[model samples]
Target: MIEISLTPIRRYWLASLVLLLLPVAGYAEDSVWKPVPLGDAASWPAWRGPLGDGVSQAKNLPTHWSSSENLAWKTSLNGWGDSTPAVVGDHIFLTLQNEANELRLLRLDANTGQIERNILVDTAETPREAPQRSSQKFHNLHNMASPSPVVSGDYVVVHFGNGLLATYTLEGEEVWRHNLQSEYGEYSIWWGHANSPVIFKGMVISVCMQDSLADLRQEPIESYVVAHDLKTGKVRWFTPRMPDGSAEELDAYTTPLLVQKDGQTQIVIMGGNALDAYDPYTGKQLWHLPNLVGGRTVTGPVLGDGNIFTTRGMRKPLLAVKLADFRGEVPAEAIEWTVEKTTPDTPSPVFANGMLFTVTDDGIANCYDAKTGQQHWRERLGGNFKASPVVADGKIYFLNLDGKCTVVAVKPKYEEIAVNEINDTTIASPAIANGKLFIRGKNALYCIGK
Candidate 1:
């Protein structure tokens, strides 16, 4: 190499300095992938668990835990919320709302029940008059942070109903924020939005089903499912739920689930007055299952064994349809069957073994054959349940709103094993990870394990 002049040497030195600082400058841009350790056998990772199907692979989960026994640890939460705890590695994450309707995200160490970080997220806007007759009076039920946090590797995604979607690192550093309701559309409901966000293939998906009955003349009263880039807060795709409708009943609060069948990926959405499927990659409508009467839906659809199971919150029938039937404009025939009595109107159904287990909003737990909708046994577990049931290690866990947890055996015959109790009520679903159980009560987050 030939020696350069002083000026050129100075320029070379500056370039070298820039390169040395390039890694620091691009630290945010670098793909910082955090390996989420498998949770304890008694811990929960997300609203449901690792599979997002409400089933835990762990075998050593505690069968009983109460206010004074079998509890690994119980920590008082700062705010009120129905959002479930999401565990990733040794950390537990959740969202809550204080009395002022201020949203907050909290992370805790799974081992010691110590809070790692708690950050204030959003403050609810002033409440307008109730718009719908079916709306419940607003209470301190932590409605603002009802949607649970979903942890994907190092990043945790939280959705605050009124349209705030945010991503934070495991260390509680907020990466980016997006106000989808303000930017895309406002919520249509009087009860407040409660749809949770889901992640798949590097995309974070959310369903905006607003039912603004008072503002019937609103221009953009459309219901849609949107996907955003997980790393950057960029819109990837948006599929409108209703093409040309202004009906508030078409709005929903149900989250969509990703299903893969026959080498094709479909995002199954149950909302408003219809059941529909969409191409997850492009947000293209694939098929529709109409004739569904719209109402306030709380439970999302569950996919299993090539079939989709869904529930409409109102006095409607529970639906189960085969996924292959969506290949055409309309299915040739009705795929399976439906049950009206004792069916779940809130909690999502869980499929384990060859049986389908569901707990209704009024606390009725029923077991049915997954292949057919035939009921095996119906029993009242006593307390009301808004959270779904979780199956782990041959046992089914039911969390009721009264803070009672019933554990049953997942067999052909129903077997009530144990009824555990905590101090506070729990509307958020239970999560299982590594080998621990994470339960988010109205007043505390509990980690039950060895």
Candidate 2:
């Protein structure tokens, strides 16, 4: 080794450079993935807001707003997607697919309604042979970008129906990506994969429930719940999830519901003729309630007041199961009550003010008491709906396919607050953040506020 003496000024500059480089090196070594701070009321960080429920803490949300009235700003999007925007601070992350089948992530300025960046995540690279004897066609209502982007700390994770799950910094820098089908197995779901990823405790969790093709082949495809490290894309755990069901009943297009009970965090999944919960860390099956099978699942589960509310599938009975001391197979008696009429098939139900609200795909809005499952009111909202309802400040907003939002108050009696309409077609569920409502439409992202 050779050493050279330097002047005092030169030594000082060299020391400054070393000091600046130290923190960068340390950060690279640590690679710590922070958890998103859900305490901030102004953030819609993931699929169903901070609590994995369709409830928003925002106040003064606009009760009446149209295309021109009470509009904050509207920014045109390049392509259409049913995935809702995930908002944190002043940044909004969304996913969409162009006509060329390019899956992309868009970072929008939440305050100004301007797209700050459009980063290509992946292309729809469906395998040449496709899966043998499996249906890969999604309904015309949604495409591959149906799964929404989720904000987890400084990184936003976007999932596409094509099995591409990617993470990027809020500034649109790509961090890591994985083709889940390549890692596990080909998707044999009847429609398409639209389950959004949820980030918890430094792990991004995803669920896959689909057709096993048991009748078509001697070997069956596996459905699974998987978790990956947020810092790296390395998979942390994968648990095979095969509920006892048949045919299309094995398929599900719903996202997992993250819930906490008795200080224990659980990832609740509803599909395949059953309802179950798993440990997010180890992907261990916790408790399951099976045999309530109906058709393929679309709506997800929601938790409110110590009860888990979910339907089997395809507008079956809406069951409210009380949170009890559950382990292994949850007994059938755990379900407290069921509402058999007007349950939603696509849009998930929202719980607010000791009641549960749901909008059927055919436009019937139904409200039931959270504890008793007694129907308080059932009224026709006059439009087809695919987006789930969001509740804020004691009011529920139900947006139909045609961009009509009927805001209703949370009361035992049916109380319609106001009906707001926009010209663009909307299929995505509404997102609330920073005291404003963000609606993703076929042509634009509209910000409505006063």
Candidate 3:
């Protein structure tokens, strides 16, 4: 969606749609095109795409699109969210919160961009923004639906800043719903909660990095990560994480990254003044690197070349942690490098074609060698950037907040492809599937293809 307007990470702990062995409910059988399974490489089932990275396996995705050119379908959305649309089979799902604060799960027909169903899962009487925050309202730029939905097999999990978590079938039948505030306590974040859920091994996982309630109440104001059963929405396991940082330094809006290397799987989570790897199956901490103690973190972390590059939150040093022999406390040698200047605060960096690309919130773009951190290129693209780039067809598409997309080649030297613009302002990242690119803006959803 590209609205000339307002706006809004997530876990890579996901299951392949093929692993979703349960059949989609019969309501979708009448479709002429077979729905793509939620776990297929070609489907955009979670934040950043199926592999949990920004790069898309899609070939021949549209390189050109505007308000009226190469437009396949355009559907108007009722509310605002900064979440990327999740595509599975022939349906697209996005969470929306209207002015009334009703969080809705909307399913649309992929081929025609026609509305299929809109299910109201939950509603919050107060604004999505926290009460402690002033001059901020959820309806203006973003709301509880900022966290993108995760589609795994037979279930689609949707979460919101207001603590609502619900599951629905592919056909939009309600399965189960719960609230984090009810399970835990009131939210203590300064702004709002936007951590999205990740699905893995039949469990949907989520985490929160919030402020301590030591000043507000007696009950422990703890931060933790937990997983729920996909079928029953029952708690599988919960692990409390107490970072040593104080106040706002503990706030984290980053979504978890599922990294697998050397035959082992770990959930890479950053927040509360540290970066830690946890076992997805048992909710156990595998390793941690602490003392980051920076401001609130927004940029989701990325992985490549045996390293994980992460923004230390709030324009702090962008640290590269090497994972060759990481165990317990991270060794000093594990930090390959730290790039302090011109790091992104909101947008996550992308690693592609032996290069690392980062765009600051103010729109400064930098490219570095993935292994040695050698500067490849640095240039300003103009405008504010919050949406992460989409990599495909040997090109990276960088989107600004004003809805301008600057396409650049992925090579040692930077080469501009084309700059395209739409009618709306946008903050949600783009998704690619079935040879088409799906973009969500302030008020509408646009599909671009040849």
Candidate 4:
């Protein structure tokens, strides 16, 4: 034992040094792969394109694409989902669920449509046992991954209906995972939650809506806008809604919109019976617009021209309110206008060039004056539209569930510019990024561009 050599000790020290530096080297490589942001108006990084308004600033986006024509590339997805694709830099990210309710995240090379990585994020612990309702009834679109993904830089965030929220690196390594369903979320309404997560600053915001069950004596079921630290999956703050204790009115399936007005950043959330605003940084409620009738909300709110526009009720009215000041309760007079009949129950509205444009779930596109509530034009594009419309290059692209996209000129007068069809059914909305359009169908993802 006294003959231990110094050479062996030196060899061990060198091996330890290399092991210690390996992680640092990998981190440095990751930091260099920052995504190239779409600087122009045509690219969309998240749901409904840029600004979360479904309006594209891009001009000259390809209007016609088929299986062989105008298509940049088409890739067959491994799993099925109703979620849209998110493009950031050279990669596109989306979520899908297997027949067994096992959720997966996929990353593809945006230019080539080659799948870079497919990672299994979460698995449903138990099989769905409930009886399937008829087509007339609204319930969880079983096995359909309906939540869209949000991407910033190299980090991609996704929410699965099973209450799983996860983040991944550009290389497809899972960074963080959280089970909102098991922790604080419960299935309440007929349709499972369909709200897409929105990113603000460094946090990811999601709406967790669950109704209180009498049998469980659940704590007053509350809907909340929760901000989580992007890197750690830790809840930063939770802004709770005023509980109504009514099971039918306790759900919110709307994504929160982050907007900047009058030098203040606000998070706007719409739910069963109210539209509310909060400070994005601290989760403090700034204002609440109450008395909204109880009905499941699907579309989130949109902000434009210093006002916030929201739709409520499964078959109700659309409301537009001006947010000129933020210190107190907004006066009733602040409501600019309300529109009844033909308001969308699923897709959100789009604002472009001083006009408000929305497509009804039945395929009617309505345009209104942005400053006033005056109706400008209403036209039937002729297909049911569950996906939202995107405006790019002064043109509006409306993707319908029947797989037809009606492109129209975004003017006060209605003008159908072009009609393109892909033959595949789609429930997810389209995304525009890097001069290309991304559409998620029932079984595939398509990239269309010039």
Top candidate by lDDT? 2
For candidate 1, lDDT tens digit of each residue in 137-247?
243444778788888867899998768999988888888999986787666664667788888777888887755343445455667889999899899998766632335
User: lDDT score of model 4?
Assistant: 0.72
Off by over 4 Å in 1: 1-45, 125-129, 133-142, 212-215, 218-220, 243-248
User: In candidate 4, how many clashes are counted?
Assistant: 7
Q: What pairs collide in candidate 4?
A: 41-57, 41-58, 42-58, 44-432, 56-391, 58-393, 59-393
Angstrom error of the Cα, residue 337, model 2: value is 0.8
Tell me, by TM-score, which candidate is best: 2
Error of 3 at 190 (Å): 0.9
RMSD of each: 16.5, 16.6, 10.1, 17.7
Candidate 2 residue pairs that clash = none
- lDDT tens per residue, model 2, 1-450: 111111232555445434333222223332321222343567898777877788888999999887678899999988888999999998999999887778889998999998889888888842334443475667778888899888877888989988888888878888898988888887888777889988888888999999888887898899999998887989999999998877788899888887753345678899989899888888999888899888899999888777888888998878887654356776565677777656789999998888989999999998888878777888899989999999999999999999999999999999999999999899999999999999999999999988
The segments of candidate 4 whose C-alpha lies over 4 angstroms from its true place after superposition are: 1-43, 125-144, 212-218, 243-245
Identify the runs in model 3 with alpha carbons over 4 angstroms from their true place.
Answer: 1-38, 126-140, 215-220
Q: State the TM-score for model 2.
A: 0.90
Off by over 4 Å in 2: 1-39, 125-135
**Better candidate number, 2 or 3, judged by lDDT:** 2
